[model samples]
Target: MDLLSLDFLILAGVMLAAGAATGVLAGVFGVGGGALMVPVLFEVFGLLGVADQVRMQLAVGTSLAIIIPTSVRSYLGHRARGAVDMTLLRNWAVPIVLGVVLGAGIARFAPPSVFMGVFVFVAGVNAIKLISGTRRWDIASDLPGGLLLRAYGGVIGLLSSLIGIGGGQVANIIMTLHGRAIHQAVATSAGIGVLISIPGTFGYILAGLGQPGLPVDALGYVSLMGVMLFVPTTVLTANLGVRLAHALSRRSLEMAFGVFLAIVSVRFLYAMFAG
Candidate 1:
C-alpha cells in the first residue's frame, strides 16, 4: 500500500499495466483476468511477506473487489455492441443470483487453503483441456443448454465466491464449446461475470472476517487499495479489448487466451503443490 519511493512507483506502474492487460484479456475472452490476476497478486503479496494463510485470500478477494467496477463498465460496453443476450441474462440471473449468495456465504466459512487448492485444480483442468485441443462445444438443445447454463452459473458463483473473480472462464468455456458464437459468448460471459462478481466480491469481504490476520489495507482478504487502483484502468481496457475483438478474429483470440490460461493454470498449480 505504500507509495513513498521510486520503487513503489515502479511496482505500481507494473501492477497498473497488469490490471489493464488483465481486463483486456477478460473482455476478449470473458475471463476477467482471474487466471492471471490471482497469480500476479499472490506474487506481490508474497514479496510483501503477507502471511501464508491470508495470501491466497488476498489474491482472490482483491481481484473480485477490483472487478466490481471494471465488470460493470465492461458489461455496459458489451451490451452496447449487441453481444449480450439481455433476455438470456434475465432467464439466467435469478438462479445465478441466488446461487451466488449461497456460494459466498459458504466461502465466508470455508477453509482458505482448501479453497485455493480447489481453485487451482479446476483452473488446471480447464487449462489442460484448452491446451490439448480437447474442448467440446456440443449441446443437446435449448432445454439442456439452459440447464447447462444454469449449472455453469451456479459453479461459477461458487468458485467466484471463494476466489474473488468474475466467473467468465467457466461461462466462456461452456458456452463456446456448446456452439455459442465466440463474440456473443464472450459478451454474455462478461455479463455473467458481472452478475457473479457483484455478490462474490462482497462475499469474500465478509468471509475475511473468518480470518483476521490478513493484510493491513484489505477489506477481509481483499485490498481495498488494490481495487481502487485497478477498476478504472481495467474498465477502459476491457472496452478496448472488445473493440479489438471486433477488428480481429475472435477464434484466434480465444485460442490465445486459452493458451494464456493454460500457462497460468500450470503456474498456479505448481505453486499450490510446491507450497
Candidate 2:
C-alpha cells in the first residue's frame, strides 16, 4: 500500500498502460473496459501469486470497478451522438443490475477451480466462433418474452462476474442476432455494463470479507491498485478513442477488436487450463 514501495510502483505502471490500451479499445469497439482489463487482471493475479480461492473474484471485481468510470466515458460520447438507446437501457438495466449483484455474491464463495475451468472453456469456444466469423456484429434485441430477457441478463451477469468482463461480447452477439443494429446494441450494452459494475463491485467488496495482503488501499476483491491506476487513464483515453471512432470506420474498428479478443481469449485459456 505504500506509494514508495517498488512493487506498488511497478504494478501501477503496468496497470496504467493496460488502462490506456483499454481506453483505445473501448473507444474503437463501443464496449466497456473489461475487454482489456480482464486479461490484464488475470495476468496480474497470476504474478502476484494471489490464492486461487479469491483470485478470480478479485479479477472480476477489479474489472467491474474499472468499468464504473470507463463505461461512463464511453457512453457520454455515444449519448452526445445519439447512438445510445435510452428506452432499451431503461427496460433492461434493473434486471441486469439485480443479476450482477446476485452473480457477484455467488462468485465470491464458489470454488475457483470450477470457475476457471468454465472460463477457459467459454473463452475458447467464443474465440473459435469468432475466428469462424459466426459471431459478427449486427442488431437484434428480440427477447422472446420478459422472462427470457431477465434470464438472459442474469446469465450474462453470472458469466461476466465470474470472469471479470463487461459482458458486452455476449450481449452484442445476442442482440445483433435478434435484429438490433450493431451500434445500438453496443451502446445499450454499455449501459448494462454500468449497471453491472456499480452493484457488482460493492458485492465483491462485501463478499471479500477482508482478505489480507490485498495490496494497499484495496476494497475487498476489487483491486485498489488497478482501479486507481486504470480509471483515470481509461477515462482520458476513452475520450480520445471516441474522437477516433467518429473519424474512423466503426466496422473496421469492431473487426479489429474482434481479432484482439480472440488473441486475449487464447491467452486466458492458456493461463487457466494450462496452469
Candidate 3:
C-alpha cells in the first residue's frame, strides 16, 4: 500500500492505461467508464491483496471518484455540439442524488456477490437492447412528468450506483424511447454521469467510513491512488472519444456499444461464477 513502492507504481501505470481506454468509452458510449473500470479495479485489487470483504466497495467508490472528472469533460464536449438535453438533466438531478445515497447504503451491507450479480444482469440487459436496435422503441411520446420522472431518475441512480456505472445505458434507453434523438440521448447521458458520480462518490465515502480492511490512502472506500492514476488520463482521452462518437453513424455506435457491453457482461459473469 505504499504509494512510492514499485508495486504501487506499476499498478498506477496499468491504471493509467485503463483510464485512457475508459475515457474513450465514456465519450463514445456515455457510460461514465464504470462498466469497464469496476472489473479492472476488481482484478487489480485482488492482485494487491485487498481484503475480499471491502474490495468491491473500494472498486465501486474509486470508479465513481474517477468518473467525476471524466463525465464533466464528456459533458462539455457534448454540450459544444448542442447535443445535450439540459431540461431532462435538471428534472432528474434531485431524485438521482437521493437514489445514489440509498444505493451507497445498500452497497455497504450487500455482499460482493450481490454486486457482481447486479453488474452482470444490468450489462446483459443493456447489451441485448443495443444489439437489437431498440432505440426507437417507445412506451410514450415524451418522458413522464412529476412523480414518474422522479421514479425513473431514482431507478437509474440506484442501478448505476450498484454496478458502478454512469447510468448512461439506462438514461439513453429512456430518452430514446421517449423520442429523443440518439445523439441527444448520448450527450445528455454524459451529464447524467456527472450528476450520478458527484453524489454517488460522496455517498460511498460516507457509507464506508470506519469500515474495516480498506486499502491504504483510502478516503472511506474511495482509493486515492486509483483516483490519482485514473483522472488525468481519462480527461485527456475523453475528447478523442467524443470526436469518434461524432464521426460514427448512430447504428455503428449502437452496434459497437452492444459488442462492448457483451464483452463486459461476460467478463463479470465469469468472475462471479468462477469465484
Best by lDDT: 3
How do the residues 114-219 of candidate 3 rate in per-residue lDDT, one tens digit apiece? 7667666765776687789874445678888899998989988987888788888778767766776667888999999999999899998998889899887889
Measured over all alpha carbons after superposition, the RMSD of each candidate to the real structure, in angstroms, is 3.3, 3.6, 2.7
- Evaluation by lDDT, superior candidate among 2 and 3: 3
List per-prediction Cα lDDT, in the order shown: 0.71, 0.71, 0.86
lDDT at position 187, candidate 2: 67
RMSD of 3: 2.7
Give the range where candidate 1 is weakest over 10 consecutive residues by summed lDDT. 135-144
lDDT of 1 at 86: 83
Which residue ranges in model 3 land beyond 4 Å of their true spot?
Answer: 1-6, 112-126, 134-137
Q: Over the stretch 183-231, how does candidate 1's per-residue lDDT look in tens digits?
A: 7777887888778877777777777775756777878877876776677
Clash totals for all models, in order? Answer: 2, 11, 0
Model 2 poorest 10 in a row by lDDT: 135-144
Stretches of model 1 off by over 4 angstroms after superposition: 1-6, 108-149
Ranking by TM-score: 3, 1, 2
Model 2 C-alpha RMSD to native: 3.6
lDDT of 2 by residue, 1-275 (tens): 67558776787789999889888766655667675687678778768777766666677788888988887778787788887878767767777777777778778666655755665555455445444555443233365557777777777777677667676766765665666655676667766677777888888888776676565555888888778888888888887877776665645544554576577566665666675
Name the lDDT value of residue 198 in candidate 3. Answer: 92
Q: Residue 98 in candidate 2 has what lDDT?
A: 77
